[model samples]
Target: MFRHTKATDLLNSGVPIHVGMRYMGHKSANMFMHYAQTLSKTHEAEFLRYRKITTDGREYQQDPHEMYEAIALSKRTDRVLPHGYCTLPPRQTCDKGNACLTCTKFVTDESFEPVLRQQMEATDGLIAERQEAHEARFGEPMSQENIWLKGRFQEKNALSKILHTISAVRTSDGTFTPLRGAGSPQGRQEEN
Candidate 1:
């Protein structure tokens, strides 16, 4: 990876972005974004001495302070997502919208189990809330035809499946087999 290279120094030389990456000896744009992300910080972000990859292909930044954080948080700084990490390279836009749980490029480990559980709970509560409001106003439960309610059920189901997988596969100390790169529930089920 590039060690403290200023992007402008290369840009001002009029050599294009790909040439700048070559100057840093980086094989991929993802590697070079490591520095771009760090430089965006107000304080010097600790670029740890040795970053390693797990057998499942997750990158781990071995920062002293980071050990206390979730394993999923140690990703290349720019790739960290809310419930997991995105494998899509940095500076690339995701066209999938907010469906990371069902997107092929997203992955999460045991570290996100708690957060996922809480979300499931929230989704359940919202489903109840919406049903109640619908009944009170319309004199009937929200029909399955309601797109919003349908979406909540889908979200709840996805969350439950993830939690179940985590529980079943977790090792005694709580580490889990990485949820195989996320995709449609059907694809994920087929893999496991």
Candidate 2:
């Protein structure tokens, strides 16, 4: 039940940086440190409880995939593969490599699957554009100003498209989730 915000709050209140890094799956302390300033001092007491759990190195806090696997295991059905992690059905004849588009299996359980497909299409295009831009600008070390300009344009474009995606996927249940965090589908499929 721990929300991402709660995990972040726990990380900034004097919790060992390494433990926070572990919890967040951040490859480096620097990644976690960037968000450290966002933590609230008022939540120190809550963080103390987190510290107590990690005081002994005996227990391993499960990784994100492990948590997903545990949930999947509990929900397994006769049709579901072992661990309830079903493989994608064969891709449609479309060359976009969209396994989800042709996959009937995913439609049964995941309500957000369509949102994921749409977002992936958007992201794949964006990534190709970035690669082209980078290649066009190659052979010269990008000046900070040039880099910032490109990054700013890309960021604004991504944010606008993501907002559109959220609007498209806001269901009758009023639950809308983004496909991935701040990156393209190729980089973030593991998060699902």
Instruction: Please report how far candidate 2 places residue 57 from its true position, in Å.
Output: 47
Off by over 4 Å in 2: 1-72, 75-98, 108-118, 121-192
What is the Cα-based lDDT of residue 8 in candidate 2? 62
Query: Top model by TM-score, which number?
Result: 1
TM match of model 1 to true structure: 0.48
Q: TM-score for every candidate vs. truth?
A: 0.48, 0.19
RMSD of each: 15.6, 18.5
Query: 146-172 in candidate 1: lDDT tens per residue?
Result: 988877776666666666655765668
- Cα lDDT for residue 64, model 2? 27
Model 1's alpha-carbon lDDT is: 0.56
Tell me, by lDDT, which candidate is best: 1
- Model 1: clashing residue pairs? none
